[model samples]
Target chain A: MNKSSAPRQSLGELLPKLVVAPTFVVAVIFIYGFMLMNAWLSFSSSRMLPKYDWAGFIQYEKLFANDRWWVAAENLFIFGVLFIVICLLLGLFMAIFLDQKIRAEGAIRTIYLYPMALSFIVTGTAWKWILNPELGIQRLVREMGFESFTFDWLVNTDMAIYTVVIAGVWQSSGFVMALCLAGLRGVDDNIIKAAKVDGASMPLIYRKIIIPGLRPVFFSAFIILTHIAIKSFDLIIALTGGGPGFATDVPATFMYTFSFTRGQIGLGSAASMMMLMAVIAIIVPYLYSELREKNNEH
Target chain B: MNIKRVLIYSILGFAALIYLLPLVVMVITSLKDLDEIRSGTLLSMPQALNFDSWDKAWGAACTGVSCEGLKGYFWNSVLIVVPAVIISTVIGALNGYVLTKWKFRGSTLFFGMLLIGTMIPFQVVLLPMARMLGFLGLAGTTSGLIMVHIIYGLAFTTLFFRNYYISIPSELVNAARIDGAGFWMIFHRIILPLSIPIIVVSVIWQFTQIWNDFLFGVVYSSGDSQPITVALNNLVNTSTGVKEYNVDMAAAIIAALPTLFVYIVAGKYFVKGLTAGAVKG
Candidate 1:
């Protein structure tokens, strides 16, 4: 604290503050200020352009009343739950298997994670074809003599959101695997050895002890996966275009449609405010708990 | 024991194939002509290696109103990404230095607010930022888009650097200050040389993110100024005389190549970058 201040002011003392000021201002205006601006617009009568008059919560009322918004919200819940769950299962399975000192681990890990490097647009493009019933697996399987093959979820209204989940899981599961693998490495080897010496089967030990201890890793994976699911605009846009009559529209896409294309600026703003609330609802508590734990430690 | 080992290997092999399938399908699809793509299954090889679609996708394919290929947009992405990554990274380094080394009153609070920026859904900022860009006369231009990237990107880049810089013992900075070395001088002389690993981490993270960005590109830029991700989406979605799946696949590959190259070349740092980013606490 003494070094951070000086008896007499020096250029060195003020320079650090000066260097950080621009970013501070940008963060204020862009992040926090923009959030406030969006909230204000949600309450205003803005439609084509932002207007400055309050209109109560009519936009939110409209959002709640609209069937499209409900479908989008429902789709987000389905996608988020499915994506997070499957990624955890598959990623944990792979990390556990790979932790067995597998052969060519680097090559296999690279293969698993390469999808994460590609843009969602690219993943969506590839999966759009791969999931196409006419040209993809359905046709191939029919050719292979399963004449009753009908894997057309890409076009099916009830199943279109699942395709997004497929691509989402494809792109992100490896990250969970990486995090889990790191967690696995950090597990106290002596504890595992003692468990083994006690004649505990490996599966039982993992189920009862090891996997339970990896809760924090799984929680981190959930937060990231939820973020990805909420921000899932490009995947849905590029893959299905939220079609089969808005069947696969998630909140982000719904907000974009209502706000930008449909000129329902107030509706979009309200939808965005909902999204902001959802993020804060999830993240704030986790961050607060983490902050409190750190304070207790000190 | 033998059965268990076999089960593990077979499952691992199957998972690897699942992971490898889409990429393989993408490459194989790009090399085939339209007829071959229609006639062949995803597993079938091209009758002959053909790069015509790649040629068309690179130079002649139409994306809605434009007849030019993804070349202009690829360069547009390059133009936006290089400067945005460098500027954000440098500013982040300075901010990280100040927040950690030159801690002042309320710096922790400032960092807390800054950390919140990282979690913000860009949707919350879209309308306001769009209006801001219009006011600044940068609307529908690459420069405006670059500024947006830098601003949104600050939280991430700063987080990475700040987390990295905290490990540097403060005694070094204090000694330098006592010797009349100013803030910038100590940073250049003492701090920056230690920042290479983290700089690699930051650059790779930012480059991957900004390059793959579709939301900002779509919302901020218009027409020719749009980045490759947006352009690729448009190129695929535009319905015309034929769907031209080959060309679409080729264009997707091109949009993906730069980041894929970075990943293959510096995968260690790429993973490290993600791990560093996950530590938002």
Candidate 2:
């Protein structure tokens, strides 16, 4: 009986490991393994297909020197900053407004939040029509006796990136609103009452106490928005096709076009590495803080 | 006070209009005939309610060499999403079960690694994945896309189930074990039965994500196996023919309809899943 039970006991102990092994293997190979291959490809002189020859940062050199790459990098900076800032402000305002115990809060909140459920592809295509000079808002307004009115940012190279920011904010501001609302609801009611009793204005209360207390929500929103901004591909693709001539290409789109279409695999891999670095820069700090907080709780 | 209430309501109503305008335009344009779309205002109601555009967008619109609308791509999404969601969710549940209930040395470390996987940009994995898929003879196949999604999706599904199962009491598992139930038995009988809510949340979340995904669809799948998002994009951006704004809008709506329906029906669980994923992250 003891001999028979020994192997069965061992199998019992191994079952969990067996169950988890596939995910573990996938995580190792697909995630970490691919990441390392990307790093390797970035350093090699690969084009059209990945080559293993050591190239010593030639791709990085070319990427930095390339004007289109510079445009993409600059576009990312503009889109990232404006998208995060606008979404945070708009989301916070909406959250605070809704938190005023207003009637029809549920309906209004749903209206704002519904876009979050839609894909960026859909968001982009819809906004594309709306922003089109001839077929959309511009034409509508032009026919509305406002003949000189112009809002043709979609096709305007200088203004196309801002169009992306606009669509992005529309899709995500509700999410930010939801996050801030959750933070607002968690605020101590007594404190707000105390401020009210002290004859503080509502704006003053919000500025001094409420906003200050929601710092963590702000942090969380910023991190989430930053990453979204970085990985923004489909929106730009559908809305502008990074267009009026690649004026709105962010790093993600740049990577795709170069690696897949342009056959500059080495350059594309380099861009991908830069994107990965940007993500890691944001994520590592966020994870460290999160894990530290959890450890403290434990 | 009355003025304040009116001001707030008016502002909110205006904001709501702005939010609804694009969707309204999409629907209106989708209903209008091509000539009316050309002459009439974009915001105007269609002169004649036309369902032909919807029919065209679904079955007759051309993408590349195929004139079949988004129908095939839609089914491709369904095939890819259903199996991927089920398999990934089951794996996630199992991983969550073991990580929490059958805790071992370095389990937290493994969980941390998985969490890190969630944060890594998919771009990092793109080239390597394409190459890897090619090596496995799965490149440009639906199975390849499904595999890619499952691999990427495991991080999220695992995160969801792990966080949820952590809240489940361990005493139940302890009792089951003492009653001579083994690992798989306890999981199937005790844990899986208790996991319905999280499973729903996981399914809804995964379904929406995989359905909406464009990057992997465009990159991995090719020919007729392309998912709807990619096909819709191709149809919209094709640039060769006269721009069929109506067909494009209809196709966009068709591509968006599944997730939209899911959201409208089970929005509560969707919000729960979003908050659980976001707040914890």
What level of docking quality does candidate 1 show?
high
**Pairs of colliding residues, candidate 2:** none
Strongest candidate by lDDT: 1
User: List-wise, what DockQ does each model earn?
Assistant: 0.84, 0.78
Estimate the TM-score of every prediction. 0.97, 0.97
Off by over 4 Å in 1: A1-8
Q: Write the per-residue lDDT of candidate 2 for residues B193-266, one digit (tens) a residue.
A: 88898999999999988999999999999998999999999888877568889999999999999998998888
Query: Model 1: what is its DockQ?
Result: 0.84
Q: How well is candidate 2 docked (DockQ)?
A: 0.78
RMSD to the hidden true structure, all candidates: 2.5, 1.9
